[model samples]
Target: MEYKNNGHIRVFLVGHAISPNRGSEPGNTWNWAWELSKYTNVDVFAYPQHRKEIEKFILEHPRNNLRFHWVTLDNFDPWHPEKGESGLRFHYILWLRKVYKIIKNLIDNMQEPIVVHQVSWSTVSTPPPILQGVPIVWGPVSGGQVAPASFRDFFGNAWPKEMVRSWRVSFYPLILGWGRRVSSLPLILAVNRETEALLRKAGAKRVEFFLDCGVPSGFGLPKPQEVARPPGPLRLLWAGRLDFIKALPLVLMALRRVRVPVELLVAGDGPLKLQWQSAVQRLGLSDKVRFLGRIPWDKMKEVFQEAHAFVFTSLRDGFGCVVLEAMSFGLPVITLDHQGVGTFLPADAAIKVPVRTPEETFQAISEGIERLALDEDLRLRMSREAWRFAQEERWDRRAERMLALYEEVLSHAHRRV
Candidate 1:
């Protein structure tokens, strides 16, 4: 295990959307960088859009082995609408030829020795050119590699709602494309079992379990009510894009059914903001619902903490990082069972809603509310359970596991040498 000749192992983490504006992804990026830094020299190579944030983050948290390198994209990476993603799939791949060399040179030029590791999304098409002999890992929670379509007709069409759903329907195809792009590369750390299976199916030689999302023991947020919040007006907080996929209307309808005086604090702004606001006005729930646009990450804990429970009504998520965040604060989540993250969560952290257009969500929310209200003991139990789980999955714990893996991977590399 003498790495004396190997010199120092350096891991280059590439995350395109690591910026302040992108709260979700950067949270993941910072944790990945922080974790990898523990085991090896981690140079955080990210898109330049986040230079300021990355610089600020690194300064606040200086690490011995971990470094941050932000990659500026003169032009955004290719996506579907840019002349048919499927058509230029092979052409888009050619861009990766450069990716390989840039990384390879870093490996070759290392004073002692080095290793390159990828944590999340890298815009490059194939394995970095220099990684031919190196162990490269990409994606624990790859964006685009989704499960097989149940039926061609099943996916939401530009439903009348899509026009008004306050979501980026256009991004759907792009999200899909991003997956195929990442899956093409070799993955060293697969975020979850589902993603691991996909990476293997796509021909990755080796994969490891490394969750893309991490949670702190506490986000400086208040714990959810030990008992449901006294049963009067339900202050339902619906954070995230008010877009189509979130099925906001179903949330609206579910709230609408509740005779209880309920208020919905809809946070996070998106394209269909006005449309959703208008719909709420149309439904005459003006007093019942309020749209609180994007709250700062540091302050988000307040919104979830103040609320009785966290509702993740989204049709999908990589692993619902927010869900983990919410649970870390001791809030129970009510979400759909169909998606990867939903099923992935411990049953104790959530109330699973059967996926149905509006009826199931409606009944589920209503039932969840009533159950929480009627059984304070149950609410307290769930709250304690969620908090315990999140602490167990805290970033520090996750990072330790990652460091162990890097040691193993590096050990393997040294043996080969």
Candidate 2:
């Protein structure tokens, strides 16, 4: 699709982390700036630690319209922001203050139309820059999704932390007065239904739903020749940080219950790795599961290609980037039907089991796995549908939507005057 620069609008993206090598929110920020730059000028404000990788990437593949401004806090190592929760929050707030000052000055002198977009650390808990006069887009942000209390067993020692997080999500908006802070913004983009509701409740005047991540161009296209399914156990790929919120134990327990032969390939490592490995042995899944610890970003494509289906068991997420990546390889998904995964993922492209009591959910997941393993034609059809859905979610398309939103915000602001 062709996109024209209708207004010659310049965008200043305010993000704490922006990098070419990173994959989560940082990579997302870079992708947004890169794609948007194709249509208009973009100035990115990001942490200085990512400066090396960002500069090297731009050197290799140049874009004249895009520029990066490194923003950092005094006396603190931008590379290692304090490790604990409180320290990180304090550091981010300080960084945001520094970014706001720089952007405010730049906007004061610019002749062309400009908009400020907060694209990283997409959470409502942190207040956005309070810049007056210019239109500011606060999200696609999310922090509203909470892990189910019934599933606390899956979290192990982290259960208490989960409880604390839920409490914060419930009360932070009122205590911090987010409603008053966000009411003045022209637009706020929400990544999921939960967050959208939260924003509206907090008195955001205009909120729109937008997915937090998108696939790249030509990512999910079909290969030259379709390889026939090899004869073996159904290979189920599960890739994510093995933290408690991921709920890998659910998958392991479900794997044991599946009557059909299946093997799960886990491709990430985290604090719960040792505990999860022990759970595998306890559940007699040593033969059925393989932990392929922390595959590099570039190599993950091959891992996805080898697997027959992808399983995402994240209890709380804005949207799992890995789910989109898996679909890009035409892997049908088996995941819980909640949060972003439940709301955005198409039914035909996945077997989304409803979140319920632990035993019930486990039974449903096992059933979904068994059905897919036995029916080759069903899997193939879902694979095709998944690939087609992924194509529609290309980053360029997302950028186009963002451009339209910018125009809308400008029009509204103009009307107000």
Candidate 3:
């Protein structure tokens, strides 16, 4: 895994998807790929053919210093006639082994210092421990946003698992075995403190901190001159999935008695779409809210521009990228301070509320929003400061930090020789 000094920092990033879908999961891969491609000669190694149009369009329009390598896997689709036709876990195993072998071959072929950044979760195989000697970065690899009940104490309520066969899944036999085993890999570059902590709990050593999400520009907010009386009370904005773990109802319950006007704009959609609509109707505060369904990328800025503050009340988040996007808009953030989302936010830029009872959630939102709404001066000040911080946190910064970490490690590996 050692390398010579003169070669390009050839990066091999593996992920489930790089297209950056609306969900948090896709953001994890896309953000990292787009950022990393900026600093190094990079190539993305992804799953079998996803969409033909995307594949063809991307192949023809590759970015500078970046390439795409699609590793076709015999994906297990029950409805497909070819499903189980492989007669073994051959495709899955071969996919993992062949990809690594390809990376090793690439190193040999190009004489480049290879960095295998493996996005580990429930499916993708953990890179061989020996690959760590080559400066590998591990994940924002959240297989599912909703944790099973066993992990509920740490991950909040049981997460949505419509595709994961429910909590009937045995942790030891499946996820924990693979994910923990992967975490135990030496010299893993982790995304956040919570992830690092989890890896440590899983016996991970030689790990370093990294921010997985990308915060794009335009810290949008209503103009001071245009906004009158700040809409009274605490005007709040909470965006993300409408799923159960999102704790949308909990956020609603918390803001129930607040004196300020609390607004929760449910942005993304999921299985719990109907339930959220029902809850909103029952709450009788529909006037204070709006559900801008599946917002287009170009219009997200307009939405962020309208809000005063971003509130995230998810039970567990793997580096809440949306909060970063919110901060980029210079909206002050108030979020749960346990597990994933809490880890990515810098304390000075946002409000971190402890994940205690639902009461605390209510208190934080009610009071926090009012404080911002009433004090125009405070909003202006925080907005300016928030954007300043967000500017420094552009995905390029994250990519550079990772590159520096990789170069440092690679240098040491070479010196030891």
Candidate 4:
């Protein structure tokens, strides 16, 4: 797709956690930045760890307008093994200072007006460092979404700790005072309704709703075809980080309740893998579950094609990208109705079960799985709907929306000046 830069709008996008070329799965930010650059001149400030990887990507999949600047500081990385999460948070402020310096210099030197856009780590609550007299666009920021209080114990060993950590989300209102410093808040885009509501309540002048992730190029290769659920068993696929928030143990417990024979392929790995594996043993579902840990994103395409349906057990999600991926592959999704995934679910494409107590949750999911397994017509219908939704939400479409939003912000900012 060719984008004519008629306005020649220059955008400085701050994406601290964005690593488009870091691993096999270039996340949403990578795809977003890549596509957005096609439309406008983008200077992306991203993590340094992905510097080499991004350089290689630019060589292979060249985008002349998109320039990547690495944001590096000694001993900085939120996920640093030694420093841990707390250390990363401590340094995040410093990182912001570095970003501010770079933006300040650019604003002073550049002839064309610059607009600041925060592309990744979408959260409406946390106010980024202010660039005096500059118009700022915040979010599709989405961190305020949380699992229900009743789900505290379902996270296994990390239960209460994870639950306790979630309480920090409430502090978002206390920090809204910081946003008052922003020169012009043209728009604050939120990924989900919950996030949109939070931003408005926190005194955001203008808040809009938009999804953070869109289907990347070259994914969802499989065409829709009649899938037969064999008389023997139902084939299901579950993919994503195996963390407490995933609520995967409930999946295992649900499988135990399923009367129909079901085979599950588990993808991705995290600290909770061993615990979930143990739970599989305890539930006597070892034979039914296959742990395909940490597979590449490409491999997931094949996995999706091989499965009859997809099960997403995340208690909370900032727009589950995998749900869209599964839909693109023509797999009907079974996910919790209490998250961002539920908010955008295509009509009749997903089985939305409420988040309930552990036992009830498991029962609900197991029952839904059973229904999908037996009803071939329902599965086929849902798969088609899912595919339709995915086709409509490609990254290019999302980039167009962003380009329009950027233009609006720039126009409004120019009027004030």
Deviating ranges (above 4 Å) for candidate 1: 1-9, 17-22, 52-64, 69-99, 109-114, 122-130, 144-197, 205-209, 216-218, 221-231, 259-261, 281-287, 411-417
Instruction: Put the candidates in lDDT order, highest first.
Output: 2, 4, 3, 1
Q: Report the number of the highest-TM-score candidate.
A: 2
Worst 10 residues of 2 by lDDT: 77-86
In the range 145-226, model 2's lDDT, one tens digit per residue, is 9998889888878889989999988885586456677776889998788887888777787999888888866565564115
Q: What is the TM-score of each predicted model, taking all chains together?
A: 0.74, 0.94, 0.77, 0.88
**Model 1: per-residue Cα lDDT over 232-312, one tens digit each:** 665667788766556566677677667666677887988778987897889887888888998887788778777766777
Which of the predicted structures, 3 or 4, would earn the higher TM-score when compared with the native? 4
Model 3 clashes, total count: 9
Q: How big is the RMSD of model 1? A: 6.5
lDDT of each: 0.61, 0.86, 0.61, 0.77
- lDDT of model 4 at position 3: 38
* RMSD list, candidates in order: 6.5, 2.2, 5.7, 3.2
Per-model clash counts, in order, read 17, 0, 9, 3
Residue 185 deviation, candidate 2, in Å? 1.8
